[model samples]
Target: MRHGVQLLLVFLVLVLAVPASVSASSEGGHGGGDSKKKEKSEKKEKGDKKEAGKAENGVITIGPLVVNILSNKGYRFLRLEMIVECADNEAAERLVKADAKEELILMLSNKVADNLLANSGKMILRKELIDLFSKYTGPDKVKNLYFAEFVFQ
Candidate 1:
């Protein structure tokens, strides 16, 4: 009886250990194939990032800008909300460190006012505003601009 019990234990240990060794060897053989799949996925991720135009670091949403408009009849106003996409983490940090919110407000306000005055109260188009800001900030530095809210009064 003692001899039979010892044999059963040995057999169970071998059965457990054999499958683990087989799986480990199989995994090692397949390791080389994973590199190609990894490379393809990495390439796909790069392409997706470019197409999305997402900031590598993040994005900044700048304000509900309230500007008084120049109108012939009465006091007109323009309110706008804008999102600024920075080139990367460094650029976004620079923007905050420079205290550019006020400066940006002034510059953007001037641009909008200039358009309104030139057209005699014709509001500026979203695309034109984006282009103007891109020019001001340098297209390389600012990835893109988005209008979250726009109201003319």
Candidate 2:
């Protein structure tokens, strides 16, 4: 009778302990999963912010302008056909009216801006022109710039 009671007590203890252990392990796993989900959501939000920033940085457009400039070295002249993106449509129109190619050559020769490749140069020139135009307009109106077509000779 005593041995039977001892065996019953041991079984009861094991049953109780097993449920507590399982509950503790399940809670821990759930907590870890929740933390991982929170971290993933935070990372996704950061990625979204970066994408928004990039979108806000510039506007893209096509161009059919001929830019003729005398190079820094007096003997060489570069003629380029380029596609440009402006911070805004106003800037784009201004660029067209001012003849960006001519302005770029003058700006580069005068050291106001650096000479760059067809694509990069157009982007830089677009920004520079936006800044120039913003002086007459307002900076809040300007965003970013890009280039779609560029040809250099």
Candidate 3:
């Protein structure tokens, strides 16, 4: 509470100081002298916003999910990571909030090492996982899926 009040006071001081400085600078023609600087600042701010927008629409990783799967010899370790391309950022966030990691763990645990290590098996697993996650992302909301990491031991 004390820190909050101090921060508020500092904010108020800065706010009150800015307009006074601006008015004084304009009166002295100093503000006009710094027009280019202001333009640069504005451009920098716009660039920052564009970067943020791209981040929102960027790739979202499901998990570096580590699970145990059944094998002919015994239980084996499976470490998998996936990224899903979504129709929109909101759909991507939904996939995360939908608790898909737990579902993936269960799905992976039922697999065998031989199937996972094989190309056909990996493709099948990818399709099944996509279909499972599509429940949360909505129909055709998932644009694509990519395996960032897949390790079976």
Candidate 4:
């Protein structure tokens, strides 16, 4: 009876060991295919992201702007460089060729003078300036505004 029990235990061990070894060998053989597939999918996804990011946002760059701000009868100043993002190719082209670009800058400068440089403007947030530009310039014309260079004095 004891010998029979020992033989049963050995049979169970063999059964478990055989399947585990077979599965490991199979996985090792096919592992290269799985890795290659994963790599291809990752590359495709990265390409898609690059295309989407480029197509949706077109960059428009302009010269730097330097302006003075007056707060509480003290002299405060801001020198800023800016870039505008346009929604599409046409808007980007218009932004490049449009005569109203200077006018838009003038309007933004006025907004800064009225809101930020005057009175208690030292506590103003940078978002306020971005909002001012966005408010004065229609959303159709400008997708987003970025301050590439900003200095406060």
Best by lDDT: 3
Question: Which ten residues in a row are the worst by lDDT in model 1?
Answer: 49-58
- Could you give candidate 4's per-residue lDDT for residues 72-149 as a string of tens digits? 556556676666676665555454334555654554455444465443553353445445444444555566666687
Q: How close is candidate 1 to the true structure, as a TM-score?
A: 0.42
Model 1, which residues run further than 4 Å from truth? Answer: 1-56, 96-99, 111-139
RMSD of each: 12.8, 15.6, 11.6, 12.7
lDDT of each: 0.60, 0.51, 0.79, 0.57
Q: By TM-score, highest first, what's the ranking?
A: 3, 1, 4, 2
- Superior candidate under TM-score, 1 versus 3: 3
- List the candidates' TM-scores in order: 0.42, 0.34, 0.61, 0.39
lDDT (tens digit, per residue) of candidate 2 on 7-44: 99999999989976676567575456567778999999
Query: Once superposed on the true structure, which residue ranges of model 4 sit more than 4 Å away at CA?
Result: 1-57, 96-99, 111-141
Provide the lDDT at 145 for model 3.
88
Please give, for residues 18-122, the per-residue lDDT of candidate 3 as tens digits: 987887577556566467678889999987654321315635776677898999999999888887888888777776653776676887899889877778989
Backbone collisions counted per model: 0, 2, 0, 0
Which is the better candidate, 2 or 4, if ranked by TM-score?
Answer: 4
Candidate 1 vs candidate 2, TM-score winner: 1
Clashing pairs in 1: none
